[model samples]
Target: MLKRLLPVSLLVSLTALGLAQPGGLTQTLLPYTLQLNPEQFEQQGLALAQEAAQLAQFDQIELALPRAQLAVQLAPQSAKVWSLLGSLYLQKNDLDQGITALQKARLLDPKSASVLFALGSAYFQKAKYTQAVDYLQAGLKLKPNIPGALFDLGNAYYMQKRFQEAIAQYEKAIKQDANFWPAINNIGLIHYEQGEIDAAIRQWRTAISLDAKAAEPQLALAVALYTKGDREQGLALGEAALKLDSRYADLKFLKENLWGERLLKDTKRFIATPRIQASLVRTPQPLLPRTAP
Candidate 1:
C-alpha cells in the first residue's frame, strides 16, 4: 500500500526538531545555502589549506592552489591561507599576484614571520633588493633561527653588493644549521668575487663535503680549479657536475641563481670545454625552475 505523504507542517516540525530547513529561521539550514558559522567556515577552510599544503609538498602546486584560493574566500581573515596562496603563486612565477596576496596576509597577521620572509623572497624575485632586505630583516628579528630565510637574506644583500652583510647572514644561517651547505656555497661565491680564490675554494670544498651532490658548489669549485691551472681536475669535475645537473651549463640559469660576473666568466669557459659539452648532450633530465639561490 502507498503511504500518505507528510505535510509541509510535519516537515517544518521535523526541521524545527533539527533536520533541515523548509521555510523558517536562519538555523533552519537550506539545501544549497546551508549557513555555516564563522567557526565552521574557519574549520573547513583550514582543512582545505592543510590539503593544499600537502599537495604542495608533493610539488603539485597546480592542484593545490585552487583549494587554497577557495580556503581564503571561506577564511578571509586567515593569514595562513593567504600566505599559502601567495607562495603557490610565487612558485608559478606570478610575482605580482604573489606580492598582492602576501601583502594581504601580512595585513591580516602582522607578526607572522613566515609571511614576512615569503614577501621578502617575492620582492627578491622582482629584483627589489632594498625592500627584500627590509622585510627579510624584519622576519629575522622575529624568527632568527630559520636557516633558509637567513640564506635568502644573504642573497638579498649579495644582490645589493653588500658582501660583508651577506656573509654575516650566511654565517648566522650556518650557525643555526651546520649542514646548511647552500649558505656555505654562497659564501664561496662572495670570497671568489673578492679575489680570495683560495678562501673560495675552501668554502666550496666544505660545502661539497656537506652535500656531495650539490651541483652549484661542484661547478663553482670546478671553475675555480680550472682557472687556477688544475685543468685536468677542473675539466673532470665540471663534466661530473654537468652530468649531475646540466642546467649549470646555461649561463643565464647560473646568473639567475646569483652567480656573479667573475664566476660566470670562468664557468663560461668551463662549460665550453669539449668534455662538459658532451656531458650536457648526454644529460636527459629537463631543467627545473630554481628561482631562489
Candidate 2:
C-alpha cells in the first residue's frame, strides 16, 4: 500500500514545488518559477561549458566559442559560466574580451578567488601591471599560498622595475613550491639586472637543477657564463637550451619574455658571439644595405 501511494505523493510534491513563485518569502525557499527553472538553465550551462572546455583542449575554437557563448546566455547569472567564458577568451588570445568576461564574473561573485586571479592574469598579459597587481593582491588575500599567482605578481612587479618587491614575491612562491623553476629563474634575472653576476649564476643553476628541461634558465646561465669568458661551457649550455626550445634563440622571443633593459642589452651582446650564433638552429637575420634611387 505504501509503495502504491509513493508515486502519487512524489507527483504531488513535485507539483507543489513547481508552484513556487519568483521574488518573495516563498521565492527564498524555492527560487525557480513554475515555468522557467533557473537550476535547469545552470545545469545545462555547466554541461555546455564542459563541452566547450573539451573542444578548446583540442584547439577547436570555432566550435568552442559558440558553445561558450550559448552557456553564458543560458546561465546569465552564473559566475562559473562567466568565468569559463573569460578563460575561453583568454585561450583564444582575445585579451579585451577576456577581461570583459572576467569582470562580469567578478561582479556576479565578488569574493571568488578564481575569478580575481583570472582577472589579474588577463591584466598581466595585457601589460596592465598596475591593475594586475591590484587584482592579484586581492586574490592572494582571499586565498594565499598559490604559487602561480605569487609568480605572476612577482612578474608584474618586475615589469614595473620594483626589484625588491618582485624578489620578495618570487621568494614567497618558491617557499610555497620549491619546484617552481620560473620563480627561481626570475629571481636570477633580478640578480643579473643588479650586476650581481655570481649570485645570478647561482640562482640560474638552482633553477636548472629544479627543471633541467626548462630553456630560459639554461639560456640565461649560458649568457652569463659566456660574458664571464667561459666560452666552451656557455656554448654547450646554449646548444642544450636551443635543443629544449629553438624559439629561445630568437631575440624577439627574449624581448617578449620580460628580460630587463640591461639584461636584454647584455643578451644581445652574448648572442652576437660567433660560437653562440652557430649553436642556434635559427640564425639571426642580417640587415640588407639599401641602394639609393
Candidate 3:
C-alpha cells in the first residue's frame, strides 16, 4: 500500500513579531523588497508554494522542485514554505532530503501541527515507523484534535502491521472529524485483511457515505467481495473503478486478477460497453446486502 501523506494547508498565521512595521521595515528590507509590503511578500511566497504543489500533483517534478525551492528562499523561516518543499521532495522519492526540510520546518515552529505531521509523514515514507509514531504523538499532544496527525499515526501503525493500534488511531481521527473518509477506508482495509468481511464491508460503506467519490473504499469493497466468492458483483465494482479512473494501474491489475480469462479475451468488448461505463457514475442506490439470499 502506498503510504498516505498528510495534506499541507498553506495557511500560515504570521505573528505580529514576524511582520515589519512601515518604519521598521526599511532596515530589515532585502534587495528584493523594494516595492513589496511585508505582508505582500509573505503572500507571494505562499502563492509560489501553492503553485509548486499543484505542479507536483501533475507530475511536473522538475518544475515543482525549483519553484518550491525558490519559495523557501523567499520565506526562509516560513514553516509553510519548508513543509511544501518537504512534500515535493517526498513526492520525488528523496526521503532524506524531505526529512531534512521537515526537520528545519519543525525547528522554526516546534509546536506547529502541520510541521510535526509532515515530519512524521517523511519518517513513515522512509520506513522509520518508530520515529513517525513519536512525531505524530508529539503533534497530537500539541493539537489534540488534529485529524491529519491521527490519520498519519494510524498509517504508521498500519505499516508495522499493528492492526489494533492502527484502528485506534483511525478511530481517533474519525472522532475528531466524522467525515474523514480516508481513515474509514483504511479501517475497512484492515478489517478485510483480518478476514472480517462483514466489518470491512460496513466500514467501506460508511466511507462511501462520507465521500462517494473516494475510489479507495470502492476498490477495497470490491476486493473483499471477490475474495469471499461474490465474483460477479466484485467484477462489476472493479470495472466501475476503472471507469472512474481509467488510468489507475491498480484497478487494471485487479480486473485482470479477478477475471483472468475474461479480461484477456474481451478487453475491447469490455471497454465499449455502456453498463461498464455507467457503473462509474454516482448511483442513487447504496450497496447493501439483500435480505433473502
Candidate 4:
C-alpha cells in the first residue's frame, strides 16, 4: 500500500490557474509588457493533468479519472499526461488500463524514470515480477536514489523469494530515506517469513517508533506481541491499529494486503476477542446452520 503523499494544495492550485488561462499569455502591468501566446491546447491539457494529479494525491480517484482521461485526449503527445493517467488508473485498481497508460507514457518518454517506476509498479500489481524487476532496475539506473523505487524493487524481489536481494534494496531505501516506515515494516515481514521472529519484532518496533500513527506496523507488532504472551499491550495495540484504519479490521482486506498466513490467523483470533468485538461498530452476520453429515 505504498502511495505518494498528498502535497499542500496551494502550489498546484496556482499552477493550474496559470496554465488554465486560455490565451496562454499573461500581460504584465509593472513594465507594460506582453508575451507571445503559447500553445493553448497543450497548456490547458497540462493544467487538467495537474488538477488530476492533485486530486489523485488526495485519494479522489473517481474525480481524478475523468480529468486525467481528458488530459490524455487533449494532449496525446504529452508524457506527463499519460503518466498521470496511468497513476490514476492504478489508484482506481484498474491494472490493465494502468499498464496501457504507463506503456504509452514510456513509449513517449523512454528516458523518464518516473514513467519507468510507474510501469514497474503496475507490473508488480499484475504479478508480472520479471517485468517489474526489469522496469524497476531501469528506473533505478536513471534515478538511483529514489526511495519509493527502491522500496518497490525490494517488494518485487521479496515476491520472487529473493530474500537477500530484497533486504539489500530495503536497506538502500532506508539509507536514502531514514523515515520510510514501509520499507522497515516490509523488512520485518521478510524476517517473520523466514522464522526470525525476534528480528521481525525489532524491525516492527523501529517502524512503530518512526511513525506512531502508521497502522500496518502497529498491527504487525500487535500480532507478534500477542503470540509472545504480551496480551494486554498487544490487544491495546491491535485496537489502536484498527482505530487508525478500520480497513485493517476487515478480513478480506488483510488477505488482499498480503498478510502472512500465521499473522492473518492470529489477527482473526485477536479480533474475535470480546473486548475487540465490542469496540467494533460493524455487526457480524449470522452464521448458517451446519448440514447433517
TM-score of each: 0.86, 0.81, 0.63, 0.77
Off by over 4 Å in 2: 1-38, 282-293
Give one digit per residue, the lDDT tens place, for model 3 in 197-243. Answer: 79988998899888767655665666566667776886687676555
Q: Is candidate 1 or candidate 2 better by TM-score?
A: 1
Between candidates 1 and 4, name the one with more favorable TM-score.
1
RMSD to native for every prediction?
7.9, 11.2, 12.2, 11.5
Query: Tens digit of lDDT per residue, candidate 1, span 166-245?
Result: 99999999999999999999999999999999999999999999999998899999999999999999989888887778
Highest lDDT, which number? Answer: 1
Model 3 reaches what TM-score against the true structure? 0.63
- Candidate 1 Cα lDDT to native: 0.87
Give the distance in Å from residue 235's predicted Cα in candidate 3 to where it truly belongs: 2.3
* CA lDDT of each prediction against the hidden true structure: 0.87, 0.81, 0.69, 0.80
Best by TM-score: 1
lDDT of 1 at 246: 76
* 161-263 per-residue lDDT for model 2 (tens digits): 9999999999999999999988988999999999999999999999999888988899899988988999889888987887777666666777677777777
Stretches off by above 4 angstroms in model 3 are 1-64, 67-80, 246-293
